[model samples]
Target: MDIQHVCILGAGTLGTRIAFQSALSGFQVKVYDIHEKSFELSKKMIEKIAKSLVSSQIYTAEDIQLALNRLSYTLNDQEAVNQADIISESVTEDIEIKRKVWTRMGEIAPEKTIFTTNTSYLLPSSLASFTGRPEKFCAFHFHDVFYSRVVDIMPHPGTNMELIPILQDFGRRLNQVPVYVRKENHGYIFNAMLLSFLGAAGKLLVNQVATIEDIDLSWKVNFHVPMGPFAILDQIGLDTAWHVTHQLPDANSQAFAALLKTYIDTGKLGEKTGEGFYKYTSK
Candidate 1:
């Protein structure tokens, strides 16, 4: 599919970042959010990121303008997708919500438009059937682009083999290293490895084996990494971590979910809300 235009659904954290990166990559990027307020937030977020890129000397003001010129935003679903060659969705982590969105998108988007989800836990095959075009559906998982430049591409049993290389090329255009997952894995490669680290650290905190600060310090001191599991969770956001934990169906997982819920219920969502496992002064 000569992948030129890319439509991104949901203007939240990852969606906004993807929109910016796609535009910077020279793809005509269309960002769609369900609400007007979300469009406002996304615009501001993209502006802040662009400014940061300039301040860091990674890009010039002209480069930022070029990216902005290539990007568009809309509230209408069908209008946002229209004739886009690829539609990347970064909505909530719930399966039902994803299925509903895919179903509607399948009914509206062009038949040639490839569909991909940014789901962290759900397998692509589980929701591919809802899209009505399983051969064109797959999982395209990305970390916070500012921190990680790798994206995991996982195809369902029904996906077309020919499309894999195209998507890989698309990832490269966005300046990302794309890893192909050989089979259907719940968390793909990175998240599968990440869960174990987060679970162990969560157990220590939950069982009072160590303080959050001390545990983070222990890992940082030993590993010489800037952040620990708790710090990573804060960056990923507690609400998002909570959803991912719920995907694990175990007593230990339930405990961790509850722990995250405690923070979320108090309106401390993470960096976005200024607090989570710890406090943050910057967004």
Candidate 2:
């Protein structure tokens, strides 16, 4: 199906990026969030990304303006999904919350609206039945749309096979390299590998094997990559990292989760809040 109107169910970091890119790709985009502050942050984040895109010559000023014009924000559930051809959900990573959101969307969204979750580690199958349209639901996970640029199209067992190509085309339109996950797998592909890498860094810190700086330096210096694991954690908000980490039934994960909670308790939720393991001048 042609995806013309895109509805993003949350105005968090990833949702904001997806909505902006959809608008950039000439889709009418609406970002929905219960929190008014989320809209403010989402708009600010989009503007920041737009500035970077323009300065880097990746997007012309006119292009950015047109994209901005195409994008909108809303809090009304019915209005958000009424005209949406596709709904990309990036709500809180909690299962109960996701189930509730999908249930509500299933009740309100048009029958033609394709349901997708931008969940980093959750399986689509787990939430498919909740949507009341298993065949129409799938996982369309994106990672740092402009930078990472890989979108994972993972369909649950009940998902219509026809959706793969449609989502693949849509991913390309949003300037993402589409990767298909043949089966349901938690964390998909890249994130499965990433979890291990990040977990190792966390273990080292928890065990006092090395300082966060030394551990990160080891990875960066060895791989000659720009950001280390801790620095990467900063990019992925500490709260998000904690949420995923805390769910793992492992001692190391639990320990890391505890460490992350300390940062979260202080409201230092990584780059968005200007402090995590590292400090950033820009939000």
Candidate 3:
């Protein structure tokens, strides 16, 4: 891959940030989504974020404009993706749907384009199986602040040796601290540790061993964790957290999943819906 034009195939939170960061790094980036509403939303979000970056002194006015100039949006998959040297798929977390998108994307893009999925759970090998060029495909993980220094790059055994450096450099240019995880497992590195911790906290809550406040303080002050499990789950979207945990098999035996179905069944979708383990607002 020549590594210039970049296509982000979703306009959700993470996708928007990825496109913005790529554009800021001087790459011609196009962000596309099946939903026109999301296309519009991401556009506004990115523009506002760019201005914030400028106001916050993260970038100069010229730098912000340059980033904006490199960005475009569309729903036509081929138009947005055909010429891209790198394609990032940030669709919802469903293996079947992801398989469908990757199949279509592989068919439309240039042969050497590096295809990647911003999947939080699915293994890299599983995703690679769906693409036309598995050798050039990988998993690129971004945390809550998708534009942050934390990043994980997971490549399958079949991934191309030549393309790895391009991705590493891409992470570096964007000020991302990238770590490569060789094997595939549910949750990769961060999520594996995160889900386990959340389980323990959930157990404490369910068992009444401690109040949410106590559980929160124990980790937040004692371990200096930025946010406690409940708060983190709130931001991550309760419905999403509930569903992923259920798939863990042993997750239902833990404190987290005991009330998982209850939270989701009751229409408490965490911060996105203004209620979950904590109350929230649309702000």
Q: Best by TM-score, which number?
A: 2
**Model 3 lDDT tens row, 1-283:** 4578999998886788888888888899988899999877687777768777888888899998888888999989989987888888888777788899998987888876888888888887887977878998988877754344677888888988676788888877767888888776778788888877888888778878999878888889987777788888887777667657666767334446658678888988676556887886535
Local error of candidate 2 at residue 100 (angstroms): 0.6
lDDT of 2 by residue, 150-210 (tens): 9999999999999999999999999999999998998999999999999999999999999
RMSD values for the candidates in order, in angstroms, are 1.3, 1.0, 2.6
Candidates ranked, most accurate by TM-score first: 2, 1, 3
Pairs with steric clashes in candidate 2: none
Query: What lDDT score belongs to each candidate, Candidate 1 first?
Result: 0.89, 0.94, 0.80
- Mark the regions of model 1 whose C-alpha exceeds 4 Å error after superposition: none
Clashing pairs for predicted structure model 3, backbone only? none
Candidate 1 per-residue lDDT, tens place, 63-109, comes to 98999999999989989989789999999888888999999999999
- Candidate closer to the true structure by TM-score (higher is better), 1 or 2: 2
Model 3 score (lDDT):
0.80
- Tell me the number of clashing residue pairs for each predicted model: 0, 0, 0
